[model samples]
Target: MNVNKNLLNFLKSQPTSYFAGFNRGIEKEALRIHASGKLATSQHPKGLGSALTHDYITTDYAESLVEFITPVEQNAQTSIQQLLDLHKFAYQNQGEELLWPMSMPCFVGSEDDIEIAKYGTSNIGKMKTLYRQGLKNRYGSYMQAISGVHFNFSFPDSFWQAWASSQGKVANQSSIDEGYLAILRNLKRNLWLLAYLFGASPALCSSFLNGKSTPYPMQKIGKGTLYLPYATALRLSDLGYTNKAQAALNIRYNQLDDYIAGLRHAIRMPSADFASISAKPGDYQQLNQNVLQIENEYYSPVRPKRVTESGEKPTDALERAGIQYIELRALDIDPFNPAGMSVEQVRFLDLLITWCALTDSPDIEREDESIIAENLQQVILYGRKPDLLLEKNSKPIALTQWSTQILAELDDLAKIFDGDTQGVYHQALMAQQAKIENPDLTPSGKIMSHLLEHNLDNGSFGLQLAKQYRNESFERDFHHFTQTQLEQESKDSELRQQSIENADELDFDTFLTQYFGSSLSD
Candidate 1:
C-alpha cells in the first residue's frame, strides 16, 4: 500500500540519541528502603504513584518514540496485537497493589508458574482491591487500580533496513520509499498512545479543577481513569500559564536555532540556571522559595484564558500541525546496558507507527469519551489476557493470537519497503511470543523478581532510575561540553569577539520587557 513519505522522512531524521536515557549509563545508588523508587515521594504508594513521578523529559521522549512503531502495523491485525502487547506489558510492570514498600501486582514471582492470570481476571482485581482495602482499612484512604507498564527497548537500524528492504516490498515514488514510510506510520500510533499515557497524571488533572476535587464538578467519572494527551501543558497555581510566552518571545526572526535552544534551556531548569541559590543547611525555606520562583518564571505555563487567539506562541512542529506529540515518562532504564534501545526495538516502533497511520483512528470530537476510558481500562487490565474485549468494538479476542495475526499482515506490508523483504514486525512478534511462552522472561516480571530478591524498597524504582540516568548523562554530557568549549576557544576569533561586544551591549531591561510584557504593546 502507498504511504506518507514526508512524515516518514521527518521521523527518520529525528536524532537517534534523543531517547538514550532508557537504556544504560545511570548511576548506581542505594535503593530507597520503603519507596517504590518511581515517585517524587513515597507517602502514598499504592496507586497513581508511579505515574506521578515521571519527569517531563522521559515523558516527552516516550511519546515521540511511539511514532516509530506506529507505521509498521498497517494491517489491522498487526495494529491490534501491537496495541494489546504494549498494554499488557505496561500494566504488568506497573500494576501492583501493596503499601509503599511491598506491593507489586505486575510480577508473577516465578518463571515456572503456568497460566498467568489475564489482566482483568478476578485475581488481578483481587490484588488491586486488597491494596485499596488494605489502605482504607489501615489508613482511611482509597486508591485506584491501574494497568499500564513503562517499557524501554531499542535495536539497531540494521534490523529496520532488513524489514523495510525485504524482497517483494512495495514500490513508491514519494520522497521516502515504501519501507521507510511503513516505519513512520507505526511511530504515529506510538505517538498517540504515549501522549495519552504521559498526559494521564492526576496532579495535572487536579490543576484543571482549580486545586479542589469537588464531588459534583467531577463525578467519579467511572471505574476507569483518565489518560491525557501528550505535549499538553498544565496550568500552575501561581503562574497562570508559564514561560511558554517567554519561549515565544525568544524566537526572533533570523534566529530560529538560538531561539529554540534558549526556550529549551529556560524550561529545562538546569542547575546552572540557579547558580546563585545557596545550600546553607538551615535555609530549607529559602531554598524552596528559590526553586518555586524559578519554577513559576521558567517552568510554569500561561493560562489558556490569557492566550489570545492572535498572539504568537511557542510551538513545536507537531503542535503547529494541530497534533501534539506524546511524551513518554514511564520508561525504566535497563539495568543491563548503556544503550536503552536496540535496533530491533526501533524497527518494531516503525512497524507500530505504520499500523497507526494505516489503521482507522476515532474522530476525537465525534467519538464517545467513554470509548477512550474503556479502551484504556481493557488494554491496561487485561492485555494479553485470552479473549479480551475491545472497548470500542466490544469484540472479544485472544491478545497473543491477535498479535500473531497482526504480524502476518505487517509482513505483507513489508513488501512495499525498499530493499530486503524481512521485517522488524516479526521481531516484535517473537518478543511477544517469548513473553507468553515464558512469562518470567518479560521485562516487568524480571524487574519485580529482582526487586524482591534484592529486598529493594518500592517507590524508589522510578527515582533511582532517574538518578542513575541523570548521573550518566551528566558525566558524559559535561565532559563533551567542556571539550567543546575548549575547542571553541582555540578555533573561534570573530564569533568570540562579536559575543564580547554583544555582551557589553546587552540590555537586561529590554530582554525582560520582551519576555514578560504584552505582545500587543505599542
Candidate 2:
C-alpha cells in the first residue's frame, strides 16, 4: 500500500487517515527547588542515573535542574506514561526536594545560588562541564538557569519512501534531508502560534533580573514579580534565549550542506564580545573564543537533528547520513501537567508538524531571520494584546486574523487524523481555536489570571503547584517502571562512569587539543 498517498489528503481531494506509526519523545527539565520556592543548592540526586551517561535521565545547566528524557514511543499516551512514571520514581527516591513546576526559575537571590552541574573526572565529562561553564561566563548564570521542554518527532522510514515515490525522488539521504528541511522552514514560519497557545511563562520572579537593567515596560506585581499586561512566553523574549550575539550569523535553511557549513563556520569564527573571557586560562573557563563553542550552542525554536555516534558532532551526523528527526524546542513547561506536557498537546503537534511537512515551504533568505525574529518577539512580549499587528509579507496584519488562517488549515488536518480514533485531533484543534477566539483561555492568560486573582507572585504560585505535584507523585504508585529496575540502572550508570575515567591516560589539555584539531571541527 502507498502509505504516503494519503499523508497529504488534508490538502488533496481525498480524505484519509495520516500520521500512523509516528515516533515521538519528550525531554523535560525542572529545577529541584526547596520547599520555600528557592532554587535547591544540592547536587544532582544519586538515585537519578549519571547525568553524563544516562540515556533517559540527566541534568541541564544547573545541578538542581533535573532533566527527564523519555524513550520514543509509538503513540502519545504511551510516551506520557513513561514520563509520569519517571517523575514518580525520582520523587520517591529524593528526600525533601521538590521540582519547580514552571519554565522560569523563582526566588533566585544571586547567580551564586545556582551551581553548575558536574559530570565526572573523565575527559568527556570535563568537556560537558566546561561547555556549561562557557555558557555561564558568556551568558549570565541567570539565563542558563531557565529551562524549557524539547519535543522530538520523526516520520517512519516507510512514510519517507512512500513520500519520495510520490515526489519522484529517490528515497536516499538527499531526499530525506530535503523533506525534513522543508519541515524545519515551515516550523520556523508558524512558531508564533505555538507561543500564543502554550506559552505559560507570562510572569517570573523579579529577582531573576539579577539586579541587571531591562528595557521592557515591565510592571511590578504582588511581592516582587515582573510582568507585562499581555505577554505570552517571556522565556522566549529578549530577556531569555533570544540574544543579539548570533543575530549576524545569518544562518540560512535552504539546503542541508549549506546548513552544516554555516554551523561549522560559526564554531570557527571569533567573537570580540566574548574574547575578554578566558579561552584557555589556567582554570579553562570556556571551550574556545569562537562565536559558538560547538554547534549545539546555537539556540533555535526548531532543529533538523540526526543521532551521532561516539565523538561525532551534531552537524557531522547530518552530513554523514541525513536528518533522523526534528526537535521542536519552543514549548514552555506546562505548569498544570506533572510531565510538563499533555497528550492533547502532543496530538496537536503531530497534526501541525505533519501539516508543515506536507505543505510547500520556501527557502529562508539571509534577511528573513530578522523578520522572523521580530514576529516571534512581538508574540513573546505582548501576544495577547487585542488586535495585535504582525508582519505578513512585510505588511501589517492582525494576529487574530493570521492565527485564524493557520487554524483553518489545521482543521482539515485534524479531520484527517481523526478518521479512525474518537476525533481527539479534532478536539485538540477546537480547543486551540477557542484559545485564539478568547485569549484569556490560553495557558499564559490562565496562569496570569490565577496569580492576579489570588494576589500571589510567581514564586508563590509556582510553589503551590510544586507542592501539589509532589504530593501527587508520592501518592500515586509507579506504573511503567519498577523501583528495582530504576535503582539498578542508577548503580550501573555509576560503574560506567568509573570505567570511562579509568580508561583515560592523556591529560585533559592533550585530549581537548586533539578534539578541536580533529576533522570533526573542520
Candidate that scores best on TM-score:
2
Q: lDDT of model 1 at residue 329?
A: 24
Against the true structure, what is each candidate's TM-score?
0.37, 0.96
Cα lDDT over the full model 2: 0.85
User: Please, what are the lDDT tens digits per residue for candidate 2 over residues 463-484?
Assistant: 9999999999888877777778
Please write out the lDDT profile of model 1 over residues 338-410, one tens digit for every residue: 2333344444444554454444333322133345434443433333333544432455545445445555555
Model 2: lDDT of residue 197: 93
Model 1 spans > 4 angstroms off: 1-312, 316-336, 366-369, 377-389, 396-398, 414-425, 436-439, 453-455, 458-513, 516-522
